[model samples]
Target: MLAKRIIPCLDIKNNEVVKGINFEDLKSAGDPVALAKKYDDELADELMFLDITASSEKRKTILKLVEKISENIFIPFSVGGGVSEIEDIHNLLNSGADKVSINTAAVINPEIIDEAAKKFGSSTIVIAIDAKKVGDEYLVFTYGGKKNSGINAIQWAKEVYNRGAGEILLTSMDKDGTKSGYEINLTSMVVRSVKIPVIASGGARDAKDIEEVFVKADAGAALAASIFHYENSGIISIKKYLKSKGINVRL
Candidate 1:
């Protein structure tokens, strides 16, 4: 069985780690390098670092932070934010990131996914989707949820997979810090829509939330920030609980 992954997410703003509810009213957590090293020590399966403001800033990702975090942690790390071109992906990977995650950039020019997959292979290319529900439709948000892509989340997921995205990191603006749990319906909808690995992000309040994610959504990984950063739960806590749920997770 494929061991499900438990990942810790670091949302960066002004080069500092921050957490917020529904992706608003941010609060400082800690230095990402230190936080990630803590999760590294805790034996986290992987780490995801997102410079949430990069897209809005219309600049490149903070590669210096990527270098710092990558050097401090031994686990595979993926970095995203303000990634606009192939050079950005190349620079991030060369800077020590195991993979490069693109969201707004992918939405703007989905050919970026094809270009990246061809140059770096699908394993190194990740398409991240920030989405929220408006009435009956799930719309993709871009520029760190500041702008709406006007595309349906599930529709874009399938399209990105067709463009050769190896993985999808789908975050729910609806549950982004509610701590209620993963957005199982949204996740399951997209997972069943695409063949690639889908990672569920947002609203992981506890271990049971993660269990519900993998069980109900069939997510390949569950990524959360506050639960891990707030010391409410650790990687081991998540893995142990997932194991108890009969899911294949690293111990």
Candidate 2:
């Protein structure tokens, strides 16, 4: 079996890393390049850089900044936010992104997933789904979690997989930045509904939270921001903890 991955997310805004609770009232976390190097040195499985406001602000991702951060990290890097066209994905990959994640564009035109995957190969495409619980149903949200797409989250997951997306970056808006834990039920539901690997995001406070998601929801990866950004924990230490718990993680 492939070892589970621990990915540290860098939410970028104004070319700087930032973090916010429930995607509101954001604050600076640090420099994206510096943090990328730090996580690389600490043996993080992968790094995800998201231009948190790019879609909402109606701009493309900062390619110059993405290239700069990409230079500092040796591990596989994923870039997302404000990605709308095939050209955008191509440019991000040229800027050194190993994978390009699309959320808003995929929802606005579902055909983009089929087109992108066909052109770029499935492993190069990642579908990011930002979901919120509404009236006993998990609905997809877009534009940096500011608008509800009114699409069922589980159904969307299966659609993306069928459309050839290689993986799903599933984030629960209700649990985002709360640091309480992952939304296990939601994660498990999506995991069961799709064949592609699911990377659980949003509400990871510590190793135990990550372990819970991996064990209970069968997530392929756990992505967190606050815990790693604030130095509350280190990637190596967390991998050590997971290893002690018999969770296979690259050290």
Candidate 3:
């Protein structure tokens, strides 16, 4: 059986690694380049670097940071933000990114998905969906969760899959920083809504939360930020916990 991956996510703002709750009230963590190297040395399955402000600010991805982060990490790396065209994807890949994720630009124009997939293959095109539960139904949000697209989360997942996206990085805005648990209902819906891999993000408080996302929630993989960021949680401990629960994971 294939071992499930444990990935560490980095939210980069102003060229520094940072984190926030529900995509608001940002705070610095450390130098992104230095942090990337640490995760690499720690033997993380993979690393994700997201320029949190790039989409909202309408700026290009930081190629310098891309090069710096990839320099030390042999594991696969994915980068996103302000990616709107094939050229943008091309530049990032050229800069050493193994994969590219698109969000807001994808919301504005989904055709970019097909174009990118055709150019880079489905394996390299990942779609990051930020969903917030509104009342009873989960709705999709864009621009760092600042704007709602009036579209349901499941529907958007299906649409992006049809557009040739390779994977879904589904994040629950409500559970983002709380670390209580994952949005199991929303995650199950997304995993069922699409045929591709679904990576669950947000609401990972402890090892139990990680186990639930993989077992009950049925996610392809589970990702966390602040818990791992603050050293309150370690990937090795989480991996061990997952293994003890009979889940396949790298030890």
Note the Cα lDDT for every prediction shown: 0.85, 0.87, 0.83
lDDT of 1 by residue, 22-42 (tens): 222224235677677777877
lDDT of 2 by residue, 28-102 (tens): 236677677777888889999888664444344477877787777778999987888999899888888999999
Q: TM-scores across all candidates?
A: 0.90, 0.91, 0.90
Top candidate on lDDT is 2
Among residues 3 or more apart in sequence or in different chains, the pairs in candidate 1 whose N, CA or C atoms overlap within 3 Å are none
Of the candidates numbered 2 and 3, which has the greater TM-score value?
2
Selected candidate, larger lDDT, 1 vs 3: 1
lDDT per residue as tens, model 3, 119-202: 899999999999999988899999889999988889999999998999999999999888789999899999988999898999
- Count of steric clashes across candidates, in order: 0, 0, 0
Local distance difference test, candidate 3: 0.83
Deviation in Å, model 1, residue 163 alpha carbon: 0.4
Tell me the lDDT of model 2 at 52. Answer: 64
Quantify how close model 2 is to the true structure by its C-alpha RMSD in Å. Answer: 3.9
User: Among these predicted structures, which one has the highest TM-score?
Assistant: 2
Q: Which 10 consecutive positions of candidate 3 have the poorest summed lDDT? A: 20-29
